[model samples]
Target chain A: MLTINDLARPGLEPVNLEISAGEIVAIMGPSGAGKSLLLRAISDLDPNTGMVMLGGRAREAMPAPTWRKEVGYLPAEPGWWAETVGEHFQNWPSQQDSLATLGMPGDCGDWPISRLSTGERQRLGLVRLLEGVPQVLLLDEPTSGLDADTVESTERLIRDYIGTQRCCLWVTHDDAQAGRMATRCLRIEAGRLAEPTS
Target chain B: MSYITLDYADLAIAASLVLISGGASLVLRLDIERRLLIATLRMVVQLVLVGLVLKALFANVSPLWTGLAVVVMLAVAGREILARQSRPLAGFWAYGLGVSTMAVASTLVTVFALTTQVAPDPWYHPQYALPLFGMVLGNTMTGISLGLDTLVTSLTRERAAVEAKLTLGATIHEAMRPNARQALRTGLMPTVNAMAATGVVALPGMMTGQILSGVEPVEAVKYQILVMFLIAGGTGLGAILAVLAATWRLSDPRHRLRLDRLAASRD
Candidate 1:
């Protein structure tokens, strides 16, 4: 479970929200609506005034690394620091199955990062974050770069991963995808969070 | 063998080298004629003033004047570092980091040299302390400036990548590790290359000066070697410290990348 209490930032009005385990909440907003910024704040990747609790543990109570590991944030464009894909993931052996689920080869770790397409990177990004087995997932446009088929597979993997006792806050621009993935829907309009009008 | 000092006429004759370079720049349409002239003037004036001050200090041999000279040099170096940064730390932090790095690095190296190697009758002897400190400080300043500049610029350019790591359970240090390595390498590369190329490719300034002043080539080389090692240490320490401090300044306590901490540089 995740709880955001009075989260407010400049260009973003304060709002409260909660998600129980295995619940996927999709947030829809227009450009410059602070959607990505909200995700960043929830991940504690930016300056914001609020209280965020994960599994009854306050964000302030735990160290940053511990919090981040438990509450994984998969940014729109994942960062790859190493030369090869294998080097990026922490536990390659355990995560190999996750890679296979994303239509990657078992030895896909040997592939140079430069060879990975944008879609591949995004899928791999999701896989990398899931390998940590986070309790809460703050994903920003997780399927933005994927093709139609790949997007379904990615969604399936995500859904399978969030089977139970896991919360997800997904930011999506696509309405159909949002409907399919989200159990609850919210809209960000003029810097404020609200239930979708329709 | 005492080398002859250059009289005013001798100095004027030597000044023709600048005129030649300025003339060449003008002919080549480099458009740097004005810069060349201004730089020449500034160098001449500053060196002459420093020369006079150094002469008085040498004659008096006081620690106060020596300390003052070192402080002034560090202040100037700090300003240079601030001016060079593309996205400097906000407020006093920009200059404070530079000054502190230079102070710690140059002071430690100068003390090490004076107390251990140089071992002058009075440890704070102006001649030995000032010049040695100046060399160490000057080189360390460049290293720190280069390293810190690379870090800030790289962090800004690669913001997404950095945040990706941060969100992946990386500590602030782990997230910026690559940038940190690159920045430190960038800072230390010049000195490392200089050391590598010292004897074969180029005769260093200090050694050349000593040799010209009639010191034995072997003796000058020994001194040059000592200074080179000292400079390496100071530059490496300052550069690492500067990058670490700058990185810390650019982040918040909650492991966030805060670009707001940086003042928008007027390019």
Candidate 2:
């Protein structure tokens, strides 16, 4: 679970929200609406004037790696760290399920990274994040390159992962993905964050 | 060879180019003025000094001066490599050792063990030793600098991916192996490519210089080949050492990445 306050960027006013464990909060906005900015702010990759509280302690007061281990952040484009996919899962315990949930075949892990499609790498990247088992997951355009089938499967994987482990803040523009994955939804309009309930 | 006498006309010609370029640079707009002036001034000052000192050393013909010059050149090259990395003094040890060892080992073997004669006066001639050593050391220094900067910057940029691995129990090496390999490959590519394309595609500057100095083409080719190998050996050693040197602190005893130990970038 995480609480955010005064999380604003240049030429933008502060906005706030809270997310709970096992909850999927989909953030939707038009292009340039700072949807990805919200996730990056939580991840400590981008500095801003605000506080991010994971569990109860303020992220500002916690060590970055400690907070980061508790909160896994994946960029839209995942960076491949090695030459093979099996190498990606060799240390991961949730490897089989994460891969299967993302609609990846068991032997998909054996392919050389250079031979992989972007969508495949993205799916593997999601598995890598899940392997960390952080208390909070921040994803930005995570399934951008995935096919409709893979996207559906990836959304399912994300939902399943949140059901099993932690809070999730997913950023996407697709109305279908929002409906399928989000327990609650927030839309960023004119650079401000809001929950539909509020 | 004996002392090289200065022809005032040749001096005038070199000086004229520098001055004309420097003066032309003064009237130029922002971006290139300082660079032109600096490049011109550096060339003029460096060549003039090297010429004067080399002439004296050749006339006096002392082994001590020659060796001292070689040491000074190595120190300069070493300092340049460290400056580019710009980390604290603590981080430069392995780089210093790496560059020095590569430079000394390659030069000694090339000059003393193989060449048999540099100047007919003395086989261990300083004029040849100092300049050749400087050239090899400088290039390898650049190789280490490029490799180190790329590795450190990319490692920090991809910290999240690395941390994901670490939390999955990937050791520092395993986490960084990807970035480390990329940087190493990029660093070594220039040296490897140059060696591969030598002679037909491009004539190396050392070989060209030897030819201009009236050395036989066959002899020049042999020396060029030797120098290329020396560069490969030194650069390979320096690049690998620079990576291991900077990343020694990637992990703490707790087995987590000690991100804060990257004092250069953390600031």
Clashes per candidate (backbone, < 3 Å): 0, 0
Model 1 residue A67 lDDT score: 89
CAPRI docking class of candidate 2: incorrect
Q: Identify the CAPRI category of the predicted complex in candidate 1.
A: medium
What share of the reference contacts survives in each candidate? Answer: 0.79, 0.10
Q: lDDT tens digits, residues A40-125, model 2?
A: 66666444678779878997676666666788877776766667877765474447776777777877766888898878877887
**Tens-digit per-residue lDDT, A1-198, candidate 1:** 899999988888887998999899999999889888788788888778889898788999998888888988888888877789888887888886777777878888899989998888998888888878898888989889888888898899899888887889999999999989999999998888999878
RMSD score of candidate 2 (Å): 9.2
**Model 2 C-alpha lDDT versus the unseen true structure:** 0.71
Mind sharing the TM-score for model 1?
0.93
Best candidate (score: TM-score): 1
Which pairs clash in model 1?
none
lDDT of 1 at A157: 88
**Considering every candidate listed, which one attains the maximal DockQ?**
1
